[model samples]
Target: MRKTIIGLDLDRESSQISYYSERSMEPETVSIQENQDRYLIPTPSDLFTLIEGKVELGQMTLANFLKTCIGYIGPSVKPENVCIMITMKEITLAWADALRNACQMIGIPGEAVFLQTHRESFCCYTLNQKKELWIHRVALFEYEDTKISSYIMDIDYHTKPALVRAETGKSINLGRQGARSQEQWNEQRDARFLEMIEEVFQNDTFSAVFLIGDSFDKTWAVESLQYLWSNRRRRVYQGRNLYTKGACYAAMQRMDIGKRLDDFLYQSEDLVEHNLSMQMEHRGKQSTHMLINAGTNWFEAEYTCEFILDDTDEVVIYARSMMGGEAESYSIVLKNLPERPKRTTRLQMRLKFISQGRCKVTIRDLGFGEFYPASGKVWESVLEV
Candidate 1:
């Protein structure tokens, strides 16, 4: 059976769902109505409440919302064959856990679910496009509610695998609640948007510009649109489903279902910048064994394993940047360990990130089975990555 890749874009205002399979050439946004372009699904207020760390009594709003969104994918795609990537405006540790739990409640396995920020979603979408589109800098303007924010993505070709980073630019609120007439509001918004566009476009050579949100259209953004299209080389598009499609691409890349995106690495704000590893003897050969890899969300990076101490009283860990540089070594001296035969003391080590720049490692003495009883002692240390 062919696996199904699903991307669900979740936000406080609205959400979008898109899917891809072996048959489809590209990811298609799932609309509530068949044969229609209506893709935005209004998110329930209760879901937002839950995302804000407040869960009302007996309310399963998030699970219900997820079920409703995934229902549009049809019955042909089974839960087991589906891999989902959820993109949102902002993500926290609690929010990520809530989304995973919601997917779990809806019959989706936790490992089958993935989460990313909207910034990374934009990067994913851009990277999946033609080379010319993202070879230079790419610009994105997202108008949400009463504010418009700009994001610029650039690729550093100097890096071996190349580094893709998106920077958040200027943002301004286009207040129209007090406008007396639609014409006045449109004119004022166009002028302000034009100014913002000019300011951003002047700094870099953008190959493509994407306009997102329900409020952006030719009618209200006449002047800004004209200015953006002034450069014949720059391509412009308007859509609200970019995040959903980007999520789909992410899922596709993860499952290696279609196109493989192994060249460029997205360096998002929440990414763990260093790889945590240790030099150990594996199968009687000494080599560096990686415990945690870089380019993963700090909150989600963790590793645990058991190893026997071999003629060493100190544990050395190496942290290296993803951009390819010398590895920095950190050591923890086990001064209180019981003096036993070399390579006889068994130890269990666990590593977890406290933040993007900090990691906490805990090691416990397990002793050697019945010969040397457990010491019931633990050593902990925090490393600055």
Candidate 2:
């Protein structure tokens, strides 16, 4: 059976809901009333007429009209198929409790509720070394017949920094001060960001990770996260699949919310494993070599290589892929190596691949004229090479 997924973007002042229908491959938006007391509620029109000098209804008299509109729309929807999206700030213990009461009143099951928060950070800052305002955001999701769920909650304290001194006088320093000599303050801010991330992870078993925000530089946040997860050694929690993208574009592409959710949740494990194994093999094959795979499909285009011999005796590799016609790459360099007195040399390599099509990559060690393909899934070839 086809399922309906609803994506709700809720803000402090208003809310928007989008519903994706699989059969029609279309989305529909439902109108929501601003005030709660306008529709279906009883009001003595005679009393209002008496209060008003004119025969026409006044602005205050519209309260009952709005209530009637809500009442008419509320009964038409099936609570079981509804999914609610709300911001993290919108959700509170009280709101959850109130939602539960509302569900009970409507004969809807609380368990059917699902929540999601948008991952985008909306706050901004300047470059004058001044503190700005703190903006908090939360997004919640729920099915029509269930309780509310929060998808993402993010809080950002914005600040403007003094622009870096440059020959061109370009404003280089922007946004909040991420790292300072005062390590205590840095730690406090980092902890808050991590807490927000952990809250989303705790809410559901996320199949993908979407990084969203408006800041020009996210290196600090990403680095802090790397440090946070670097020491985590448990395999059960170690293997996580993440897909990062911008929030606005993701929303635009996710016309079918149900399909998007399903796709994110059930990505292929085999593909991930194959890519990782391919990287290990290529790194083990050569001291300094460049391997490029070019194709027409996302699964086919990939490039990876390593520079093993440098003055620093470090392994450097770059990899990238052209998935969906977008080229993305990453490079890593490692330093220091052992000499061959005991033939004990530490080997490391980095590789990057960008693909526009599906292609198989094979790495061969070329000793002047001879070539040998590294074989094995476990990456033992590093010691041999």
Per-model C-alpha lDDT, please?
A: 0.86, 0.30
lDDT of 1 by residue, 1-385 (tens): 6667899999887899999855666888988988988898999966776667556521368888888888888977677777999998878766766777777877787678888888988999998899889878999999988999989999998876788998998899987649468888888899999999988878779999999987898888898899999989999999889999999999888887666777877887799989989998888889999999998987677789999998988899999997688999999988789989988899999997767798889999999999998899899999998
Q: What is the lDDT of residue 59 in candidate 2?
A: 32
Residue range 1-385, candidate 2, lDDT tens digits: 2323343443322333444444555444434544443211233445333323433343333333322322433565555544332222223333333333444444434443333223221111001002221112222222121112223323322312211110110111123544555455455445555555565555433222223222212343454356334533311111101101112222323333322322122111112112222223344563323344322112212344432233342322333431333333332222222232221232333222222222333332221112322222122112100
TM-score versus the correct structure, for each prediction: 0.86, 0.24
**Candidate 1's C-alpha lDDT?**
0.86
Local distance difference test, candidate 2: 0.30
Any runs in candidate 2 off by more than 4 Å, and if so which?
A: 1-5, 32-75, 80-90, 120-257, 260-385
Compare the candidates by lDDT and give the number of the best one.
1
TM-score of 1: 0.86
Deviating ranges (above 4 Å) for candidate 1: 54-60, 105-107, 309-315, 323-326, 331-348, 362-381
